[model samples]
Target: MHLYDGHFGGMHLIWWIIWVILLAWIFFIPADIPYQKTIKDSPLDILKKRYAKGEISKEDYEESKRILNSDN
Candidate 1:
């Protein structure tokens, strides 16, 4: 039984490569994770923006805000 003998083996090298790849995949490379994409605007927020930009009348903004906030 060769007790490691203070030498690098094939399995040891392969494991090092595997760990490096796994770590790089986990940290360096970017992937689509939750909350990583651009945030979406809620209907109410969009309605407010439109009203602020003069694209929507005040009545339309109020009605849309009510509809969005309604339980139904």
Candidate 2:
């Protein structure tokens, strides 16, 4: 057995203790968050709702609906 020198031995022991604590902390932490469901409305549905509410003209509504449906 080696006698404890003042320099390298104390530093090595301190580093090892720190490393173990860090590893334990990493292993025990929760990985997943709770899921929340949000209501997602499509653009055409929103346009139709606005049209029904008299927020947009019929021509404008049709134009916007056409634009929303056309992918290319």
Candidate 3:
């Protein structure tokens, strides 16, 4: 049995394939860049959230709602 008969060709091919896959993985990975924008809630949506969290009284909520609706 000649151990070196096909070792060079087979191992060289496998190493090349593994190196290509490693390079692709390094370049294609996901990143959260600093310039990426975050979604912002609207004024009315913020008001609704505050009311739901008990930060505003019902009277205040209704008053604010009326004012906001009138503005539109």
Candidate 4:
């Protein structure tokens, strides 16, 4: 047995730093890029989102939905 029987040593601090950097990369990488669009939203998806956000009424939504569905 050596001296200094404590919990955290040099490697523990390094691991903590690695974990913090990994978490930061996971959380912020996608949002950090302003112009990089990962998922391309379709016209139907846009219409759905607009309807969900109250930008279009139900009647108009149904009419546009029918038009969009018939084209495909």
Candidate 5:
């Protein structure tokens, strides 16, 4: 019935849109938790790193590589 009432209605609609977008953002954004492991490296890749670091012997590296390759 009044201009001020229509303005209030528009404000309420904007508030609802803002809330929906905020909720969608909160639900859709990817979170990288520190404790969760996102396995980006392949098993052989990890084995190669271990061999390079001297954490595993060359013979062990070759044996593990053969086993892993045979799996596929």
Candidate 6:
């Protein structure tokens, strides 16, 4: 009877350890994490990027920038 009780106690301890390890893994492990890309630019910065990328010529860039800054 004593040996049986001791074995049961050991099993309880093992169960608790397993439970804690599972909880820690769930909290610590980042699963299915989303990918995010950051843009650190304002509208003006975006305009500059477009100009730099040759999407707009120098003359067109300046004209567009002026238009953006001007109030309707």
The lDDT of model 6 is 0.84
Cα lDDT of model 1 by residue, 1-72, tens digit: 675875657778899999999999999998878867678997778889999999989998888888888946
What are the per-model C-alpha RMSD values against the true structure? Answer: 6.9, 10.1, 6.0, 5.6, 6.4, 7.0
How many clashes in each structure? 0, 0, 0, 0, 0, 0
Q: Residue 5 CA error for candidate 3 (Å)?
A: 21
Model 2 per-residue lDDT tens digits across residues 1-72: 556656567888899999999998889875655585657888888999999999999999999988988964
Candidate 6 residue lDDT tens string, 1-69: 586766677887899999999999999887765676555786778999999999989998898889878
Query: Which residue pairs collide in model 3, if any?
Result: none
Question: Scored by CA lDDT, what does every candidate get?
Answer: 0.87, 0.86, 0.90, 0.90, 0.92, 0.84
Candidate 3: tens digits of C-alpha lDDT, residues 1-72? 788788676898899999999998878977677989978997889999999999999999999999999999
**Best candidate according to lDDT:** 5
Q: Is candidate 4 or candidate 6 better by lDDT?
A: 4
Which residue pairs overlap in candidate 2's backbone?
A: none
- lDDT for model 2 comes to 0.86
Give the CA lDDT, 0 to 100, for residue 30 in model 3: 72
List where candidate 1 sits over 4 angstroms from the true fold.
1-36
lDDT digits (tens) for residues 1-67 of candidate 4: 6445664477788999999999999897866467775788999999999999999999999999999
Better of 1 and 2 by TM-score: 2
Candidate 5 has an lDDT of 0.92
What CA RMSD would candidate 1 show? 6.9
Show model 6 residue runs off by greater than 4 Å. 1-40
Can you list the residue pairs that collide in candidate 5? none
